[model samples]
Target: MGKLTRILSTAALSAAIASVSLTAAADGTTNWRMATPWSGGPWLERDAQSFATHVRELSNGSINIEVFPGGTLGSALKVTDSVKSGVAQVSHNYINYDYGKDQTTALLAGHSSGLTPEEFMLWMYKGGGAELYEQYRLDKFGVVAFPCSILGTEIFLHSNKPVRTLEDFKGLRLRTSGAWAEIASRLGASTVVLAGSEIYSALERGVIDAAEWGSPEMNRPTGFQDVAKYVVLPGIHQSGGVLECQINKKVWDGLNPQQQTVLRDAAKLSVFDSWLSSSYADLKAYEELKNGKNEIVRLDPSFIKAVYEETTKWEDEYAGKNEWFKRVLDSQRTFKKDMQSWPEYRLQIGVSEL
Candidate 1:
């Protein structure tokens, strides 16, 4: 080859290599798809939207999350598998929705510990449950878990007939979510499992005599009160349940440490935001219901005690049969016992507090 031709070829090669290196360095921004089971108007949907915004702000637009609400990717039940199988890069849903995958996953939502939303947040994040979750549940699914949000104590049963006593719940066909349905069934109510969006129609059509959707404020928009005039108070089943944000393992590892930290902080903030929404909405809903002539009946203390005893039975039976679940419950119970000493009374309350 001519000397001039060789010099030109070497210069072109160097320039091409440098261009490729620059391109790689500039690939700092990451775009992820997040799937949510919540409909566009639900508080959880708002939570996801806020989380996406915070993530963008924290990462300075270097990381972008696109949310698909209404289970556009898949139903709430499919969230765990979707992220695990790489069908979605991330998912937002309650841990109880995936109880079958690993019973331990539902421990956070279970009635056993009687954790308030805030205490659950502290335990799930600062306490060792977060570590164990990452170690067990997420690792098993090839994903990572983040405590994204919470719904404080589910809305009590909105019923056609008032449920003030244990006798009233007998033969009552009530719609519930997750393991709570099982608990309700054992409590002598005929339990029907239905999604939140469907509860209104179900109640109206006599498919369910009663239901617990969420906080009263959250449920009011669902039109439950329009169909059922009775609003039962004091949620016993889901006392401020925790919801999780799950990321595909490979997608999580690809992010830079700074980007990951931003995501973690964003999710943590979302938890607080969701808790506040529930608290504010419940207070407002209570006032509205009272003024609107809706009968708000607190469950009798006797019934509450009976329900707690039954829940303990359920927990004991499951713990005895499932070793992994047993370990998680034991760990959570220990944590709860320790948290009782915390200055916050929210940490100290139990089913008795209801």
Candidate 2:
């Protein structure tokens, strides 16, 4: 090549490198864009913010994350891919949001009658759940993840039609997400997948007959109570679940050990914070719903019994289909069985397990 051509090529390459370098922090600090699926200030959204606060406070300004509401960086439901593809360096996600990538994600996210919120947290830290999830996250999405926050059991359904029995769900059009949608379909409900924003309009216009969102505490302000005739209790479809923080693998690899620990510790703190806040908010939300016009309907024991039975079958069937599904299901089942008698012991001694 001519000297002029070679010189021009070198200069162009240098300019491209300099422009890319400018996206990083000038002070040698690590900056991240955290995309989350939640736009409203539900506990989920606050969980993302709370995690960022913990990271900032604990990292002492070395690692800074800018929070972006859902859809700011990409499709709210697809932020895990957004992180993987480098549209964002990090994301706060509902682990099951990536169910399309790997079905076992729902097992990580939590499912019907699997574990309570408290037990799920315990299992993650104490029962080898965390290690398995890290492996799964890395393998499935090429991201590093922590269970950053959790929700208590959600309301089963907020429906204009009363859903008190197992038969009541037959032919019912339900708006839901993740594994519940699959299981609900198996139980004779025609399940429709809708984002949080689409639920209200679909419900109001009779596009869906029923919907299940978050816990009563998380649901109160959504005005579901105003439109639905009945608010179903005791979130059987999902006992409880962890919300996840997903970081790009390359970004995670770049951080020093201390910065990594800061992120881990911050994620743990977010979980603890969410537990306390959800406990309080859910109590108040339950009372607030009691005063609202909607009729509060508790799922019949028979209905719950049937759902749990089907839930087990669902797990067992998937365990046969997917290796990760089997591993996660086995771990959860083992952890849950190991704690089976604790609730009875607590009740007999006048201590509440909750």
User: How badly does each model clash, as a count of residue pairs?
Assistant: 2, 0
Find the 10 residues in a row with the least total lDDT in model 2: 15-24
Each candidate structure's TM-score, on Cα atoms with residue i matched to residue i, is: 0.84, 0.90
The pairs that clash in candidate 1 are 153-240, 155-214
| Model 1 C-alpha lDDT per residue in residues 82-201, reported as the tens digit of each score | 777665777777777777665666676545346777778778777776666666655456678877877777667889988988899989999875667777888889988876668888
lDDT of each: 0.75, 0.85
Off by over 4 Å in 1: 1-28, 110-113, 341-354
lDDT string, candidate 2, 1-354, tens digits: 699999999899757644543165777666678888877686446788899889989988777788888888789889988888777888889888888778898988888965889898989999999889889999877889989898788888889899889899899999997888888898899999887888888889889999998887888888887778898877888888888898888888888899889988999999999998997888899888889688888888998888999998988998998999999899998998999988766554324765
Q: Model 2 misses residue 64 by how many Å?
A: 0.9
